[model samples]
Target: MKPSKLLITLLALGVFASLAFGQRRNQIEFYGGAAFPLAPETFKDYTKVGLSGNAQYVLFPSPRLGITFNVGYEAFSTDDEKFTDALSTEFTGQTASYWVGQGFGLSPSATVKSNLLRIGAGVRPYLTDPEANTQFFLLGQVNFNLIKNDFSAKEIPYQYDAVNDQLFFLTFNDEEY
Candidate 1:
């Protein structure tokens, strides 16, 4: 199944299970947010920020301790326009043996995307008294990710005409993360 659909199914199951627990202090939560690529210059050069959604089940076994299970999904597509411009710019004023003394121009289009499914467990320890209206806690988690990528394009191989100095579509390459 699609990752997003699986996430929704799991979330629905969690909601039903939460109701079955019958008045316990345990909780089921749904949350979502966005992330922006940063720090690594290469990552920022090719990715646009994407939003993510998650479902979490927190089990309060004691007044100060909670165990958590979570599942989430996020995806990002390649910055195609920016990447193509960069490629064209880089190839400009360049010649290759295959060019046969006439440099070929590049005009390519592509769709490169990546998706992630994260599943994990963690422990959260409440710092303040349980009776307090507000509390702080520390959490530690270990996660496993199921990742998928859609690297596809609709374009033919780069074709160049040496005699007439003409160039047609350029080939699309898979750029993996």
Candidate 2:
């Protein structure tokens, strides 16, 4: 994300926080849970259901109205076999004549991650008296979601030999190209 966009987002959240919490009705909430994949069959096939966590602050200025601010993170790990197969299929279907590979044989040192950050704010309106110990509410929220993926497979270790009309790959000890 660009600095300017991030700045704007922070400013917006700050504005929401500045709204008052009155009558001594304020709470902090935290949650840790699993993230399920719901869309795009390919994504579900390649990535496992992963971890998610969140924290939020809620302030109630009046007995019936509450404002909330939240921050959250989510992560998903890919299944190497499925992910590599998908990539290879896509690459070969394209003009990847110079490329011939099924998988990278990525070592433990290789890193691959898909992560997300969420910042959001919302209003909660109490169905019952918030001043009472028991309360019910409806919430409506707007969120900004940012995703980052890090993929470092190290060297792919694939080289094509024109004379031999073949591809040599995953051979770390073979120095003579």
TM-score of each: 0.63, 0.64
Candidate 1, residue 63: the lDDT equals 68
lDDT of 2 by residue, 26-109 (tens): 889999899886756755666678899999998877668888999999998777544444443453432122242333233312
**How many clashes in each structure?**
0, 0
56-93: candidate 1 lDDT, tens digit per residue? 99998666888899999987656865555454445543
TM-score of model 2 (CA atoms): 0.64
Model 2 C-alpha lDDT versus the unseen true structure: 0.65
Model number with the top lDDT: 1
Q: Candidate 2: where is the Cα deviation over 4 Å?
A: 1-21, 39-45, 93-111, 131-133, 154-165, 168-177
